[model samples]
Target chain A: MSELISGSEILMQSLLKEGVDTIFGYPGGAITPVFDALYDFQDRFNYILTRHEQGATHAAQGYARVSGKPGICLVTSGPGATNAITGIGDAMMDSTPLIVIAGQVQAELLGTDAFQEIDLVGITQPISKWAYQIRRPEDITWAVARAFYIASTGRPGPVVLDFAKNAQIGKAEFYYKKCEFTRGYIPYPEISTKQIESAAQLINDAKKPLALVGQGVILGNAENELKSFLEKADIPAASTLLGLSAMPTNFRLNKGFLGMHGNVGPNMKTNECDVLIAIGMRFDDRVTGNLKTYAKQAKIIHLDIDPSELNKNVKVDAKVLGDAKVSLKLLTDAIQNAKHGEWIDSFKEHEEKEFEKVIKKEVFPENGPIKMGEVINLISEASNNEAILVTDVGQNQIMAARYFKYSKTRSIVTSGGLGTMGFGIPAAIGAKVAAPDRKVCLFVGDGGFQMTMQELGTILQEQIGVKIIILNNNYLGMVRQWQELFFRKRYSSSVMINPNFGAIADAYKIKNQEVKDRKDLKKAIDEMFSDDKPYMLIVETEKEGMVYPMTPAGDTVTHILLGDE
Target chain B: MENENMTLYTVSVFSENRVGLLNQISIIFTRRRLNIETLSVSPSALKGIHKFTITTFSDADTIEKVVKQIDKRVDIIKAFYNTDEDLVYQEIALYKIATDQLIKLGSIEEMIRTYNIRILEMNETCVVLEKTGHYEETQALFSELSQKVNVLQFIRSGRVAINKSKIERLSDMLANLNSRKPEGYVEDDEYAGY
Candidate 1:
């Protein structure tokens, strides 16, 4: 037997062995044992005390997305675990690798309905990759190792480890072994040569091929391989919302974003392309628009690590089921070189039409109230596309995604699949922690910012150097826009009577500015980014602003509404 | 993943017996709106492996998806689905009745001969009868007994199934893995793979 150690100490050792130096969490009654042990282990760990357990999870997700390492978050039982459910669901949808440890009531008191008790494993089971309860101290080492392995492998996802209080205090022999190959859980499926050859054959023969990329390219670390594949074949590619920054904004073959509010060209070309190659993306309904109409003319090829995702949304003619990092190179090698100039030019025509009609007005407005896109576009220009663009959900997120440019991979951090508001502030802090060298600029709506405004305390406490740009339209703009379009402009509970954000920032002892005029906008952004410390730039954006190039609900991907007409 | 093309499919899930593993597997079936017709859990031939035998009605598409999801669980070894034609199955049931009520019916030996049941235990107050057969066959005896005399206690085991093939799928998979294993390859721990 190895030397006996307390359950809490086993957790610390297990975490340390997994290369976790930074921890994001909230401590509470059931989890006090772990926190008490962490006090002695402070010299080796950097513990971030998030105001809410929910914030911790989103922060962890942000960190994971940026660093390519599984984020570790700890929360107490009961309400603490329940609060973090949204983030867990968000991580599941976006494929962010996170290890969420929720403290549970004592093992003996598990079914007694003890104080602060929660059935954490039961609640988290559906959303998480795995939910295991550690009722005894001895299970810590194995569970932690397994959690890390299961979380960070294949299509990465969140895993919850429910820790009972008794287990935290109990003593047991400690030992840890890194998991290499799990018996049934195959993270990396064996790549098939037949599939690769077939994929190559289809792509080589296609006259009009469009590559619809997703975040899998970034997660698989196949950005270079993807670029090489696209360049070799000279195929125009567009990215899903999460798939942004997999290829830089200005790459020649990189068309634009895809989805409902995405760039017009990519949305239209999706229907036109005779052959659609989807890499590392599930055909999310938002991206596909309508099942019956989406890519009906195209022979679809899907490449992903998860077999379940292959026919989940769209049927694939050729399925390359493996890590795209490995498969893309093989696919590139097998395919014969070709060009689709005329096919590519068709996409360009639609894009040019979009630029003339919508992009110009959104990004270069000279008069009237300040536009969200204008500020985003200018910030991209100001940062020289070097800063990471993080956004909270709703109008701000779409505008930021549309206008903000990128120069690097893992640069776009936003809650895509589970569009959780208030994801901005905490996620930005996590992003800053993951990439201390890079500038993390966050664009959040006033409605979303206040949702997790308590995280502002966390920023001040840690002095995280992140630039926050709150697009204060004074309304929940996304819903308001929806109501305006579909609900006959009856804005029911969409508008907000808010507080002084500048005052809130001052109370937190952080530098802040409110930009109401266009001239002040540039200066305010400059001031926000001038210093390394936390800064919030509150921009008074147009309350009536709408995100356009809309594919009306159940409409075809190609038929987008450019304006009210 | 549920669809209208419903058919009887037996989904066998092999896993390490773990806390809440049964609940996790059941939840998947519930989410797909597939009702479990019969279920059983028992240790497998292989050490440290537990097998869950579940019978449910679902199309091939839904079952395939559900099996894939079940296999994705951390401790699960593998999951497979097969139609009734692919496997041989059986179930065991027990019936306990008052001796006085049973004696009132004439030709007790004739009843035993026709129903294919054996007496497990006989006491002053009650007699226990055991029957092993498919679900319908067991149910037929249950109907006859309930009409003749009230059953003091009745219990039925879930369906236990084995593929009609000569070799088990798990054994085949292990053998294939062994043959492909590098020369002189040794496991770090005997139970680690499980």
Candidate 2:
């Protein structure tokens, strides 16, 4: 025993036990003791002092997102703790694993007008996966351990630990033994065997079956299982934004992304499918243009980890709630090979006919501005078929989904639920941090890049080599496109007078290049890829460019407008 | 230095009974130093609660730190400025003036109306007048009417001092240290290492 230690020490000890190497935090009166204790452990743990509490939280988010480790941030009481709300909400919406520690006024002083006191647990309750306040020092070890487990396991998200000031100073005997989490709250609802059987039945009987993969597939690492099912059943697949890179986009039956901004092949086929095996996706509103008419005739088979999500949106003929990997394995085992030759023929014919419907205009002038496709394609080529592409949410996110290819699960990180701007660059920095040697390219929109422009400092400071490809459209093209399609072109507050990204990179002493034409895209990327310092490529494109084939909001998926048609 | 230019300061406010008054006062002060010394509230005989005092050692220049914070709290009806020697002030005690004695001096009616003193009770022999205000103001009103009526015993509160303006002890200490001959400055705490 290392003598009796305070709850704050136990919290730090639990982090060490979990092999957490670093944390970000700011100090204040209520949390001073924790920082004081941390002083002695500085050699064992790296603590990054942030300029602001929110900065610490976002940095932790960046660390966790890329490292595949639970990110941790510490903040002092009252306003300091409240400052982390935005970052916590970001983590919650993106389903990233993060741990937040906030110091509270002493238990005796709680609800009293004590100095620097705030009700942090109640404030953070709605935005966190779970929030707990430790009034006793003895509960620190278990609470910290449980926080890690809850944050990293299942569908990951942020968990908060609100520690009272006294708990940090009070001493108690500490142990490092790991204990099993009480099963009562674990919620091990078994996957329905009948539903699995029904899923198999649907897979065997249907023609033109499409597998719509989402983030859950990556969370479950169901790529191999998914591929096996797809190959055995000859089913084509389309990925959601979060699901991008869950399956190799280069595969023969990959339809790419399927939604408003997705590929023509996936969107058209999604409407034409007879059986849709919607695996690991929650059928977000973005994916289902008009819920009533989306996959109108297709019988749906939904598989997810959270049972509550099943039939919460579109009613399914079969709903399997277990880990997607396990569920897919079981469902595949139950299926026998059956050929839907007529369905396959119809899908291929429809794909070709729709492919012909595209206007096929060479929008990029021969030597003029760089097209978004050309940049994405060059990055794909330079990647040598092995790099992970992380995308920010915007038109770039959509373009990457349509064009970028992935070879493994969780190879890409993108904001799906929150559609938060500034997520891409930091998340890319995070991905690079997680997979140091792998080439990681961040696809960001000009609008989204500005949200986290400061993280470029961290990139230079840490010397993390991440290739940033900024699509300079000068507007929030996604929302603007929505405005054009449905909101009567009232594009308010969507346009951006973006700064010169190359200049910004130069200010950070980062190597950068500007791509003006499709012809220069490949050469620019190749030249930048050879150097090690952080590089940014700004591709200036048309100002009012709109993502096509947009399904108007609240309208049927089938009610899509073809720009030329 | 402690009396004229302290690094920290606290001040107390006595006000009419009302809701959400403390919040308004504290927010203004907290927004400044984000520090509070100590605050106490209790009932006084003048039909309102008596605020004890703040013992902040800060100088007059930074006194706005306290005043601005107090303004945001809802309960405080008004704030007053005080120097250490201006009046003998104590936050404790209640004083009552009687009407029968004022009639003898022939000054009771004018003083009572001007101060808006309430008549708490009446009998054949005496009537009690209740007046609530700051200790100094109450005392002033008490003295002006003292010759006219039989003076009753008055209660007094503890010492709560506000420093004169433009003196800050901590800033002076830092300035003094900086102006001294060159010496290696080693931080006393781990945080100062930054």
Best by TM-score: 1
For candidate 2, report its TM-score.
Answer: 0.70
Chain B TM-score in candidate 2, rounded to 2 decimals? 0.36
lDDT string, candidate 2, A40-64, tens digits: 8999986766556766676677677
Give the TM-score of chain A in candidate 2: 0.91
lDDT of 2: 0.71
Q: Tell how far residue A373 is off in model 2, in angstroms.
A: 2.3
- CAPRI tier of model 2: incorrect
DockQ for every model comes to 0.42, 0.01
Error of 1 at A170 (Å): 3.1
Off by over 4 Å in 1: A1-3, B1-4, B96-98, B108-111, B121-127, B144-154, B175-194
lDDT (10s digit) by residue, model 1, range B89-165: 99999999999888889668977898889999988899999999988889899999999999999999989999895
